[model samples]
Target: MIMRPPGKSARALLAATLLAPALATAQDAQGQNVTLELNAVEQVDEACRISFLIQNGHDTDIAQAVYEAVLFDTEGRVDRMTLFDFGALPAARPRVRQFVVPGMACTALGRLLINGADTCTGDGVAPDACVRDLTLRSRAEGVEVMG
Candidate 1:
């Protein structure tokens, strides 16, 4: 029966616990999943005015924000980004930031203005009863260019 001193064992356990989080972060960074994030953004004048803040989607990920306003000239298609200042995300907390990135054209972004908390409104007990309205903002003033 080789019993270690209780104090020593407790210190070792505490040290492990403290280092666990950092080790976990390193593991996640080495993962293969390339996660992209669009926290939040304010569109000024529907075009020509967009501040950008981008992250790699990890809790402490760092990334550069780049959004060339020229992704809509191709066949009038435009890619859009949504904003959710309120409400949390699935399996994570809600994060908000401003960003502009070269997007795929002809995209529609929806922001639940009023009912952003639930974001679930298939409340139709019958075939179709509940109806919700989302602010669908289409990409505007983007040229046919991508980078």
Candidate 2:
């Protein structure tokens, strides 16, 4: 917790208060803009791994990212898949997050989440039929704290 000097809070609050007009101005950019769209599965492997993609929505300059997940049925199974959330930290190298599916190592989904640097979800796919959601996480800037 940050401790403030006595009476300093009042002065800070008075000086930093935002006006109604200012709030409206800051929120003026709100809109239902399409940031990205999921593409089809490019390939799958013997390990049941899956690969998928998403296309950046209509603008090359907008470097957004995609987030995705997968589901299975009665006969379906997965072991683990590593995802690279490229959109999480634009300048950072790709991440490889491994999730152990509800199955054996012999049949893990060969496909995993591939975060895009906007518009480039990579030319990849899985080799089998599985329910995987290709979702996107958008941002105007890389505003994340470093560990």
Off by over 4 Å in 2: 1-46, 60-64, 74-147
RMSD in angstroms, candidate 2?
15.9
In candidate 2, residue 117 scores what lDDT?
23
Error of 1 at 41 (Å): 3.6
- Expressed as tens digits, the lDDT of each residue in 1-147 for candidate 2 is 999764987877765674656765544432212222222221233222222232322212224333333332224443233333434312212333232333333232232233222222322322110112323442212111110
- Cα lDDT computed for each candidate against the true fold: 0.32, 0.30
Write candidate 1's Cα lDDT for 82-141 as tens digits.
Answer: 442322222222234443433321233322122122232112221111111111222323
Report how far residue 25 has shifted in candidate 2, in Å.
Answer: 31
